[model samples]
Target: MTKPLDLKHVALSDLHISLLNMRHKPKTTKGRSNEPILDDILPSIRERGIRQPLLVRPEPTKDNKNAYGIIAGRRRYFCLQAIVSEGGEVGGVPVCIMNADDDAQAIEASIIENMARLAPTPMEQHTAFDKLSKKGKTIAEIASVFGITTRMVKQRLALGQLIPVLKQAYTDSEIDNETIFALTMATKKQQKDWFDLFSTDEYTPTGEQLKAWLSGGGCITVEKALFPMEDYKGTILTDLFGEHDQFADIEKFWSAQNAAISVQADEYKKDGWRDVFVGDIGRHFPRYDYAQRTKEQGGNVYVQIGDNGDVHFHEGFMPKEEAKRIDAILHKKPDADSNASNRPEMSGPLLEYMSLHRHSIARAHLLKHPKIALRLTVAHMLTSSGNWKVERDYQRTSKESTDLSLTNSRAEQELATERQAICELLEYRCEHFQLYQRYSSPFNIEDVFGRLINMDDNSVMRIMTFCMCETLKNESGAVEAVAVLTGAKFEEYWVPDDGFFDLLRDKSVLNLMVKDIAGKSTAEYALTDTAKSQKQIILNRIAGQGVENPSPNWRPKWASFPSQSYRGKGSVF
Candidate 1:
C-alpha cells in the first residue's frame, strides 16, 4: 500500500480551496462564483479558533513552493478569512496532508470530513454517493471509505432514484425526512400520482399519514416493538413486495407490551423511585403539570403508553406543587403556597381548646393546694407577673355551644360552689356579683378585713387561695407551670363531649386519638372514614357502648398538666 498521511501546521496564507471540496460552491447556484455562507461558523472561529484540523493535499505553485489545497473544512477556511479581514488575530491552521496525485481520494476524504462535522442534506449525500458509484466504486467500498455500513450506503444511493421535482423540494426543506423516507417506499407510478396531487392546492398527507397511505391502515411495523420479538406468540405477517413486516394480532401485541411496561415500572420503583404512575393507553402524559427533578430528591416515574402499543418511561419527575416546595427548601427561597412552610401543626381552635382546658385544671388544683397557691401569689406579686391585678379570666369562647359546655363542666360547678361558700364566710353578698367581675360586691373593704381577722387561719388562707385561683389569666404560661407543679389530675376533672369533638378538625390527630381510645385495628379501619365517623367511634368506645372495653376515664393528651399536643405544636407549656 500507501504511506500513512502526514499531519502539519500550515500557515493560513498558503491554503487554497481544492476543486474536490464538496461544499466549495452552492449546488443550486450554477454559473455563479459566490463564496459559501460564513455566518454560522464565523463567531465560533473568533472565539474558540479552529478545533479540528483541515484535510489538504500538496499542490505545485508558480512561485516554486508547495502550497496546500483544502479538500475539507472549506467553511472553516472562509471563516478564518473573514476574521483576518476584520483585523482579528489567527494562528497557523492545523492540516492533515494527503498525496498530491489522488483526485478520487481527495473527494472521498472531503465527503467523510463534512459528514462527520455537520450532517449534510440527504440530497447532497445522494449526489456525492452517486458520483462515487459512477467512478466504478462498489457500494461496499464506498461504505468502507466512509466507515459506515453497506446498508446505509445503499439507502443513501436510493434517494438518487427520486423524481427531480421531489429532489428540489427536499433540497428546499419543503418536505421533511420522514415524508421523504415514506415516499421512497412508493412505486414510481404511485410517486407520480402523489406528485400530481401535490402540485394542486389540495390537501396532501405527510409524515405518519403519508406512511399510512403508503401501507394501508392498521399496519403496525415490527420495528416499533418495545418487547422481545421472540416472546410474541401470534402470527407475524410479511409484505414482501413492500418490504414491511407487521404483527397480525393486535390484542396479543398489547398484552405483551403492557406486561413490559409493568416490568419497567417495577424496576424504576426498585431503583428508588418514590412513585410509578402508569397512564391510560392513548392518553398523552401532561408534561406541563410536572417539574423535572433528580432521582435522589424523591422524584417519581411516569409510564406513558401510546395507542400504537409503544411504551415510554419518563423518570425523575414530580408534581408541580411538590417540586416547588422541595426547590424552595433547597434553594432557601420562600414558597407562599406551600402548606408545609411556616405552618403550625395544631390549628387555632385546637390551641384555644388546650389553653382553656389547662387553665381550668390549674384553677381546680390550686383550690386544694393552699401552700402552692400562697407561693404562686407571692411570686406574681413580687414579679408583677401575668394579670396580677386581681383580674379574672373572661373565659371567652368562639362558639356559644363551647361556652355552654364549659359553663356546665364539673370544674366550673365546683369553683362556683366554693365561691358561694367563700362569700358566705366573708359575709359579703350581692345579686350582681359574678366570678369574672372585680369589686362587684356591695360590702366595703374595711368590713371584709374585719371579718377575715376574726376567722381561723386555715379559713382565711382558703379564702385567699380562692381569690388567687379566680384571678389566674386564661392563656398564661404561668398557669400551665402551676398546673404541672400542683400535679393536677385531668381524668378526675374532665371528660370528652360533643363540644370538644366538634373542635377536633384535623383527621390525623383524630385518628391518633382513636388509636389511643379504641384498639389499633379499629383506628386503622377508621382511618379512611370521615372526621364525623371517627368522632362517633371515639364516643362509642369511651361510653362503653357497642365496644368490649370502656375508656370512660380516658382524657386527651392536651387535658393533662404541662399539656402535650397531639400534633406537637402550639402548646403553651
Candidate 2:
C-alpha cells in the first residue's frame, strides 16, 4: 500500500474499469466487429491473467475527470469488473494510455490495429463486406481494396446469408463451392426444397441430381421433396411404388429366386457405346423387376436391368425381334411419351437469336453497301463467354465464362479494355448497319464492291454493333454516322456519301440501287461483264483492305471496295 503498484506485470482482473465518454458501439457487432468474448473472457479471467491488452481512454466525468476510460477491450474490462464484484484484488493492472485525442483517432486506431493482426475467416470477411455492401459500395471499390475479384467477393458475401444449417455445414466442409454457388442461384423456397434431403441420413445427393434440381429455378421447400419425388422435369411422380415405377417389388414376389436374366438388343451393340451406362448397369445387375421399354436406339431398343451406378432398374426390351430386324431407317428417337432421357436444352431462345440475326441480315441486304452471298455456310467454333476465354459472348457457357482466367495482370486489363471496345463497336456498327439498310434494301449487289475498315478496336466494335443492331441517330448538328465511315467533313464539303453506292454508283464494274438518305439521288450501279470477269481480283483487293485497310468499317463498302475486279465478288453488303 505504501509503495506505488508497478503497472508492468499485473492481472487484468486486478485493474479498475470504466466506460469512456464515447458513443455507443451497438453497431460494433457487424462484420468482424470485435465483442468482449464475455463468455470466454469472464470464465478464463477467473482462472488466469488476461493474455491480451485492451485499449482505454480517459474518462471525462466530473468525479473521474483524470481517470482512464475504456475505448476497447470492453469485453476484457467487463471480465475485470465482474471479478471485482467477486471480491477480487482489483488493483495495479498495467495500462497503456493511448494518445488518441478524439473519437476519430480512436476509431482509426482500432481499425488499423484490427487490420494489422486480425485475419478473419472467409465468413468474417464476408460479414465485414456485407456491412459495406449495404452502404452501396460498388464491386470495383471492393475489388481494389481487397485485391480480389468482384465475383469472388460476391460469392463469399452471399455465403454468409445462407441458412444456419447450410452455413455450418459449409464451414465444416460438408458442402463444396460449386454446390454453394448453385444454391445461391436458388430462391429461399427452392433452397428449402432440399432441406429434407439434408436432414436425414441420406442428405448427400448425387451431383447430377442436385444440379438438375437447382436448375429448375423456383421456390423449393422441404415439404415438396418428401411426398412426391420431383422427377427430372420437376413434375410430381406419385404412385412411386407401382409397376411403372423405376423400382420394382421383385423381392416381394421373387422371395429367394435369384433369377439370372440377361436381355440385349442390336441397338446398344450398334451405338458402339456398348460399354457406356448400359453395359455395366444392364449386365451383372439384378432384376429389381422394374422394367420399362422407353425408346429405340440406332436399330433396336434398350432396357434397364437393375440399380447400378447410383441408379437401379430392371431393363430389357419387349417386341425386340421386330424392332431389331429392320435396320433400313432406324433412328434413336424415343417415343414422345417416354420419360427416360432428359430433354435436350430448349432451342427456342436460340431460334429467337436466329430470328434477330436473320432480320439483321435482311436489313443488311437492303443496306446501301451490298455484300456477297456464298453458296455454303462455314461451321462456327462456339465458346461460352462465361470464362471470357473467347471473344464471342454467344459462344460461352456460364461456367466457361467464369473460368476465363486472364494471362496476367496486363491481360486482365486488356480483356476489360477489349470488352469495352466491343461495346463501343456495337454502338457504331449497329447505327451504320441500320443506316445502310434504311438507305439501301431489297436489291441485289452481286456486282457491287466496297469494304469498311477501322483500326481502333473500340471504334471497330461500335461499327460491328451498328452492323448488328442499327446505326445511331446523331443530334441534328452532330456528325453523320456515314461521315465517320467515309473520313469526310459534312459542312458541304464534297463528302459524297463516299460509301458503297457512292463509290460504285458511276463505276463500270458494279450495279447498285441507292437512294441518298441525305436527299441527293436514288441511283443504281451495275458491274459490267468485264468487271465480273476480274471479280476475283477485285474482291481480293477489297478483302485485303478490309483485313489490312487504312479506313474504318464506316466507309461505305463501295468506298472501301477495291477496283480492278479480276478475282471474285467484291464487298456487296
lDDT per residue as tens, model 1, 175-260: 78767766766667767877888879999888667655654444467776878998888777443323456666777777787777
In model 2, where do residues sit more than 4 Å from their true spots?
A: 1-118, 135-139, 142-147, 160-181, 204-209, 217-573
Backbone atom clashes (below 3 Å) for every candidate: 0, 94
Q: Candidate 1: lDDT of 259?
A: 79
TM-score of every prediction relative to native: 0.35, 0.27
- What lDDT does the true structure give each of the candidates? 0.73, 0.39
The residue pairs found clashing in candidate 1 are none
lDDT of 2 by residue, 1-573 (tens): 223222344445333333221222444332544334455347656787676666655555555445665544555576777788789766555555565355444443343333322323455455556655665667666655544567667666776556766766665567765565555544577667676677678764434355445534222222322122332223321121111212122222122111212222333445442222333433653222212133343222333333321223222333335434543346565567676567655488987887899889876775643222210000000111122121222323354323332222343454445445543532322211222322222111221111222133344334344332222232322234444565643222212221322234343333221111111121221122223322322332232321234221122233322221212474232
What lDDT does model 2 reach? 0.39
Compute the lDDT for candidate 1: 0.73
Query: TM-score: which candidate is best?
Result: 1
